[model samples]
Target: MRTVRIWAEHSPFDLKDELKKRGYRWSSGDEGRPKGWYVDIDEALEADEVRYLSEHIYRRDVDLFTQIITPFERYSVRA
Candidate 1:
């Protein structure tokens, strides 16, 4: 899964809204990280798609990490 974490030095919620404008869907992280917010691609993407997204997407000060989500986890996150 291709995922990106968008956070800021201040105004974390605003950063997440910025991510949404660029087509990323935001979610607070998995179980242990209740406060961490992120945007993710729920589906498995093709290699080329992954490359294109990573290269073309404009990122600011954000933590981009791969999110490992189970079916239940996905269901729990507020879309």
Candidate 2:
């Protein structure tokens, strides 16, 4: 199954607990990536995952865009 790594430009500190509760893990800026929390989910869950994340991230009311990082993963940016 394909997996997708999800993360954002800024670490949503306010959502830390919720994120952890949902199984997201912290990444310490390894390999040029930004420091933040991330979760890898099956590609099939992309829509729901994006919806949930977009609702709680900073500036929740605005639409966001995705920057494809790979065939199976991407970085989310605020619109």
The global Cα lDDT (0 to 1) of model 1 is 0.45
Best model number under lDDT: 2
Off by over 4 Å in 2: 59-79
Give per-residue CA lDDT, model 1, range 1-79, as digits (tens).
4343332222345455654675555345464553443445544553433454345443333334454656666577575
Compared with the true structure, all predictions reach lDDT values of 0.45, 0.67
lDDT of 2 at 71: 46
TM-scores of all predicted structures: 0.35, 0.66
Error of 2 at 1 (Å): 1.6
The model with the greatest TM-score is 2
- Residue pairs clashing, model 1: none
